[model samples]
Target: MLSTPNKQFSIEVTSDSTTVAPPLLSTTTKKLFIPPWKVPETKAPMVFPTCPPSCNKEMSRFNLDGSLKDLGSYGFWVEMCGKLFLFGRRFVNWEQNVEECCKIGMTPIDLELATDVKCINSLIGDDDYRNRFSRYYWTFGLRKTEEVVSSYYWCSSGANITRNWGSGGEPNYVKNASENCVRMEFGRATNMLYLLDSNCGLVSGLSCQGPIIPKTCDSPVCPVYTCRKRDALFKTLADKATKVLIDPSKSGIWVTNDTRLFMISYPSDTKTFVESLAACCAVGLKLLSLHQEVMYSILVGAFNNASIRGEKFWTAATDQGCKKNFGFCSTNRLVRDNARWASEQPDLSTSNGTCLAVSSDGLLHDELCNTKMRYVCEGRAQIPSLLDAVERECAAEFKLTRSEVKALFNSTPDELREKCFLKCYGEGTGLFIDGNLAMDSIFAAFQRITFDDTKRLLDMYSAMDYCTNSSKGMDECDKCGSLLNCGQENSPEEFEEFVETVQLTITESPLILPPVKGVCPEYECIKKPDQVKLLATAKNFTRFIGQAVVLPFVLQLTVVCNKKFYVFATNVERTLSRNLAFCCDRGYRMATIDTKEKYDCMVQNRITTFLNLPPGTTFAVGATRLGKLDRPSWCYSDTEFDFNLAEDFVSNDTLETNYGIAISFEPPLIMKAYETSLHVVCEK
Candidate 1:
């Protein structure tokens, strides 16, 4: 517990990016000091190249002095400073060579550094093996927009070329030649590895070096990160609660509190729609049919209090077929009574979005029921009485547990109990923490944390403690003014459990492995610009291994409309607004699909959207709608729906069905949406 002193105490701690801890122990002064630590650095791993076996035919068997060489190992590879460089003599156009290297899982020659120029020259200068080329070897990743000097840049990707890598007075664009591609001329030349631009279409040798990429999902190599914290929490709860007991009348359901019931799916398994429903029925719980707001709030509050807060779970609510009347499978209640729809969701626009699920935000969404998902079965005991229980409860009980009690009274309250539990864990773990924390003296000293992690450790400890002792009555503990002396007035023991130990809610952020992109060299690097930018940003994240980008990566894509305009989808959640006032400084306005042909072209690409959300989850489109909601007209070119298009991306008919316009990946007739991902056709 805590010691009473004449003066107040404070802990001063400083730490590095990874962790924080206090160092000094001076109780008399009442000022605890902490030391700083530097994050340790580890050496980067050395990568090697494994070229395709068929590349052997491209190598020369003889040397200049008539000495024969294997020339195997993919047409002569050289290792320089840990990077494996593989040289190929496959004659092809510059762009084609780049794609070929990409297919083979490598990057085109990027002679960015002076050392690269020197090393490449040393490898190709061996007269003993150097005579393997025509007049020159292609080494391009850039194009010459003009014949002038300093006009060259790495196209396909917006990377600038390092200064002075080209040969002196070279890239001359000799004799009006289309010297858009760079090449290296072999030996007898004073300036070795001197780069010069040549015709991009000319056949020349290819050089590539980089990492491999697993493009498809479900590949073992595909980046995938799962949040195992959720499953682990449920498993631990089930293991410890084995003796806490389950009601036989309710079957497998765990009576978490006096009113609510819960049945977490087995740790090892998940179920689809039919399986989940049948499983719930067998257990007599019925997949948690939250018939009213009061019931929904009660379940969320109890779940938040009994740990495992802020995770996704399946609910009993579903439209099943985009039917206007969606009801609880086990009840006579409809969802409209206690609606909990996520932004632009419960999208009855598509039949596939039938099953309902709840996320940490407490929003219910319509998803495909057959989609395998973890679920719960909930029920309530028959308080078969002459009256409702909340009205009969004492004021003290309401104050002590207002979060749960409020729900019983049909009052919606923000999450409070879960936040209080988090505070307790923080108090249990650290003496020096952020913010102004006014807590009891006994609780302050219990901050000797030795657990590896607070997630499972706090929950496990709480379940084992079975917290029962409380010196303070429920009447005074719930008042904000009593926080300073919130705990029971009693002598502190060897260790004191946190006030909210009986109920805990430790949350873990979900991990999503990003789409994989291959590593490329800096010089003359040509590839998809968007993909290049994505890789560049991903490289900084060591934990994700260049595989994950924090959410909203799709916002960078821009569509070139009929090769005429860059279409930019504004980040409005639903229906682009014609509010140019938001971007008046940049003269940005909403785009209009007034022309049927223009809209058709954008639609042809099947650019899916996030249901026209205002949030910039993807690259923005420069478009908007104008006029009143009922009599709305397009604002493109400031005209009243006057443009004619060849084909419509989303017809006026579909707009009425959706209540707004948004591009989707699914083709004409019906709409399909990939969960959490949407396309924004931005033309800029």
Candidate 2:
């Protein structure tokens, strides 16, 4: 829905263009307040205590496989005396350095490490890294207030500072000025370090400490793979972007390592035809189609690997409200002749309706439109139109030239005009809100546009966080420019990958069918006085059943062969003796499956009702095993014993208890049990 910006536009001007009038007001604005140190007159110089002798102890460097491992995205990491110290290359203000450490999942060098001059010297005092470590380096130490000169404490641990003060009683607490942050300055002549109280806004190199964990190629914190901290902001975005993001391990979705994404909802979360469409739409996906055997096989394989057996998931294939031949709901493409089907499937009988469901065996089955069943959803990687629209709109509003816009991909503009342009772009894309970096919004937006290209999105997301953290303390306009610059300098591959993906045109797929007008199913529940009363009674009975049953928590009610059935299973486990009393409380008795027709109906519904139930879940029935395990007798004085029901249980003696007949949903069987607690199926 977004349009390209025009190359040129006309602006209204005065008819007599010979002379141009100057504006009445000055375009530049004056600063409301300025730091005392920045003033031309009365500027006080920074003071530091005398350099202390370096610690003479030999400090050993931490290593993995006889070599120091790369630990972070930026700054050189040195492991000494079982700790990781980061010598930052870029010089930034104190606050920016602190934010940088946090972005890399580290903290500013705390008091314990700062006091160890030997460890610090081992990292930056040597020739290999001396030039990169700037003159002043920031630490976690801070003075809480100027009123008390000794109020200094380590910001990371809140421990009081008793020693490690620079010579000359350094914390002078300069009058009429604030200097709360602490920094260590290198002495050029002595080749030693001196502690100084510096303004928080002063630029300095970063010195940070990380967790003592060893960094290896396979470790999450190892820079060799990808350096990123999965902070709270990332977790929040993941929760909100379930549809567009694929976290294969726990998201109930899978990818073919190419582009297509597939997912399924099962059992308790089943939906009807119209409800399924709405559910998929809510999550930015569409109902999946199994038009090819390979596609169907992949889903079946994933389900099998997940231990999902004997389940059916709805697909987009249907013949309703269209031509008589079965076709996909959206594309209207006829179902291929080779499409896998169950034996005697697509029975075009009016009773079966027209929709189709794919079973776990990779076969399709014709089902009714209103039948509730688990359904599959699908998505693919493609740039979202909403993001494209936002980019074009922001560029046009800021009036960025085509060349300037193109340059933004590989380099950040240094001019004021380009800085403001980046600010507009950041706000429009939700990377920044109210002039502050919003990592959560940025991640969500990226997931929405990239459609869960995990490899690219994660890399870019990490680079963006590093850039934003590195730009802390800058004015909003400059902050955007600095962030863009940092991104280009640090992670060029991510930017190139992003550009390549964004340039690809999205292939549109028809996701919804035309309105199914005037072809509603013939069955409809009409409101009538007596029928309404019956419905209310049924609702109360359903609620009562939940309270009367035992373990397995059965709450389903079905009617078969003119008999009303109630499955009673509460959250508790109860023995057969207790379940009998519970059934009587509801004015019903344990179910009797005497006839073969009733038995068949129960088995059919059992597959649907017990699809998600736990194994070893048993329900008490109306039969009793009076004989040995070889032969069993029925209940009600042992008058009727259906050999068919007991055929499979004759060889299993563990199920033979003093109680009576019970059915297990997992194995779909009838067995004898007494002492064992079980759920109940009552029929009146």
Candidate 3:
């Protein structure tokens, strides 16, 4: 096993990075080239991305409300303009596939409108989705009437886009062969044409198009709820930070609002974990030591509620630098516990597991101190570790030392071009991950890309697109899983001269990328948007990037897609005593969170907060405190909220900085407006 180091270090040598060879002789030439746009990239172009984890979870045939909830996560569920399309399972009969969709509440695709057909095909065509068996899927829209080719009509609508069919005569009927079914083939990265008629019993992929919103929140049903848009997701964090940073009128370094900073941790805004103990000692707050359930939940809720996805900052929980044998660095008194392990966690097999970082999943993972993960500093500023990481990728690929990379970054366009920037860009070609355009990361990759290589990359991608569409893999290129395995790395002998050339100039000044069409890639630096254009070349690059940058796409994809996971409503505001009466009188106890999943759900709805509500603000949850002096009993059940308490119901009465209130117990339902008049929401 490769063990990660606990100290910041520089790369002595690059990985088995591939060198670019002159293209294999082909009829294809430089006549074709597309511009590389600053957008999202993917291996296969599908309408909806490959279903995310939450969408792909193994669900039951029925939800709690007794509805079909088993939408195959393997397939794609797209809802567009009052139309629902399900590109369902492979190798299933047209009849069975349509029946499955109908059982879970959907009808087979009706390609009555040319646009509808285009949209469905766009999912396949744009995403370059192809059938594995090369077999087409069944569609109900096309049917044969007489033995004539012109006899076919759109089953759903009589008048339709007649010119929509592919070049190959569709609805082709052979001698006595039943052409009752319409099927279309989708190859990855290929522009699939119109549908064809085939035998009904023939096995093929399934795609069903119907209504936009399903009547039930069930399988074959993907509920897209009201969620933060791409731009709005990270806005809250920015607004709160701005308020604290700009307002000279306030001294709230750690503002405790409904959404901003919740707890005073070791240092989330600025410092790293190296001399972290001494740093925190200079101030007041120590590394976060979660001895109590309330502290843990508040922190977890704070982390989960943030719209930013996949991002994790360091907490002061570790066994390193402990005066006592096994405690946090800042507080030698705090002891370690095994209860928080997230199912086979704290991999004690490595010494580096001594450091810890908290994630939005409400659990802690062991990490090395020098993992290049971001951490909040004293009052502000993120630790400069991750920034240093971007610098490293630039240095290694460009064959430039640290100082040279810095000079290229700080230099003007003319200055960089003088340094042979275009050649450097060519050298860094084929560095992207499947040309995935999504570019949806908080950390910008230092994409040392140039004009010539960008065009080369695009050219190669277009050529591959041609090959896949033709179903004729390029010369010496097998139709592998997605794209070609035909790169310099795959066949190094062809690029031996290229490697020798790059290595020959190693000790002296290396060649930079040359200008193409009198322009360098990103010339004029129209925008120097941070460079996560390329991935980190470090070993910990994958692991470190794993913690914060990649999770947002997948982790938050399904997070916003559960509109059917109903959140009930109310504005009933009363004291704990009166709210309890209201709930009991209505045959419902206050809501209670019985599981970690429920806690996460509550956080998703923004129903749970760290804010201190006035006397009549918060709803009385199922959490019970028999006497004023008694420890609160958590884990109470509330049928209406469909929840049970998960922990202790202890909180500050006067709203101390350390002890703000959270329902602690999961209560189902309600949205509250931040008005002076209390708008209490209870389990409905």
- lDDT, residue 156, model 1: 26
**Local accuracy of candidate 2 as per-residue lDDT tens digits, 1-684:** 111123111112122213233222221322111221131234332332211111111112225343333444345566776767777644456666665555444566655445467666654455344433445678877776546455677665556665555767556755513777787865533456767777776656567776555454321110011212223212211112211222333424443312245667745678876567666655446677664333565577667765778888888777664434566553323576667989988776663347888888888898886889988777543212324544454455567766778777567577766776677666544455445554332333343333324344444555565566557434566877787676566666655443332322112321111111100111111112232232236632243332222223445566665666777555665554455545543445567677667767766666225324565466776654322344444332223456666434534554433435566544545554554454677765
> For model 2, what is the alpha-carbon lDDT of residue 518?
8
- Cα shift from native, residue 636, model 2 (Å): 99
Give me the displacement of residue 80 in model 3, in angstroms.
2.2
Relative to the true structure, how large is the alpha-carbon lDDT of every model? Answer: 0.38, 0.51, 0.35
Pairs clashing in candidate 2? 549-568, 549-569, 549-570, 659-674
Cα misplacement distance, residue 314 of candidate 3 (Å)? 9.1
RMSD of each: 27.5, 31.0, 27.2
Give the lDDT of residue 410 in candidate 1.
34
Instruction: Write the residue-wise lDDT of candidate 1 on 1-684 in tens digits.
Output: 111121121112222122345243442322222211111134221121111122211113334543324333234455674455656533345655554454443456666656777776675564323333223455544553443444555432334554544555545544534555565655433425656665565544456655332221110111112212222212211112111112333233244543345666644557775667666655445566654434555666655754655666677666644354566554423565337778887665554446677774567877776778777776543221101222222222334354554352232223444223223323222211221122211121122121122233223222222222112223322221122222222212222333222111111111111101110000110112233234334221121222223323223222346432222333234222222222211222334455656656655653334234343233223322211123324322323342133223323432322222333333332221111122334222
Q: Which regions of candidate 2 deviate over 4 angstroms? A: 1-73, 113-115, 146-150, 213-684
Error of 1 at 346 (Å): 2.1
Instruction: Summing lDDT over every window of 10 consecutive residues in candidate 1, give the lowest-scoring window.
Output: 517-526
Positional deviation of 123 in candidate 1, in angstroms?
Answer: 89
RMSD of 1: 27.5
Task: Indicate the worst ten consecutive residues by lDDT in candidate 2.
Answer: 515-524
